[model samples]
Target: MSEDKSNRVVSGRVVSNAMDRTISVLVERRVKHPLYGKFLRRSMKLHAHDADNACNPGDWVRVEQCRPLSKTKCWRLVEIVEKAR
Candidate 1:
């Protein structure tokens, strides 16, 4: 990988790519309920930099942490894991 290995990496689905060189990703994680011993789903929207604008809505992608490129963008697209069908 060209990027630093220490950076955090996560996978998510592209939610939007309307902005130039940027894509919004929807990341979902399962969290265990502290009291009930049940699993709950939580999700967040992340703004990831996609230099090629190659990601489309519903595409699965991997993003890694990097120096903040903007006020809310600190993650960058690493690769497209799956394309929308």
Candidate 2:
């Protein structure tokens, strides 16, 4: 049996460029402040694999944890959640 255990990393689309075979995914999460006790927006930039180069801006995509594709890319494009309208 294959032995691969990795947690999936999901993020929203902040920018998608097929020309460079990469997509800039924006992940947003809520975090409570230590002293303020209020939720704040926390965003992160992630690079995902785009084999077919089929992705555009403003598209929700799900990325799974995988080997590093580039220096800062450790996720692969699993599927597009919603297409840009």
Give the residue spans of candidate 1 off by over 4 A. Answer: 1-5
Best by lDDT: 1
Question: lDDT tens digits, residues 1-85, model 1?
Answer: 5974698899999999999999999999999999999999999999999999899999999999899999999999999999999
The 0-to-1 C-alpha lDDT of every candidate, in the order given, reads 0.95, 0.83
- On the 0 to 100 scale, the lDDT of residue 7 in model 1 is 88
Candidate 2 — which pairs collide?
Answer: none
What is the Cα-based lDDT of residue 28 in candidate 2? 91
Error of 1 at 77 (Å): 0.2
Error of 1 at 63 (Å): 0.2
Cα-based RMSD of candidate 2: 2.0
Judged by whole-model lDDT over C-alpha atoms, candidate 2 comes out at 0.83
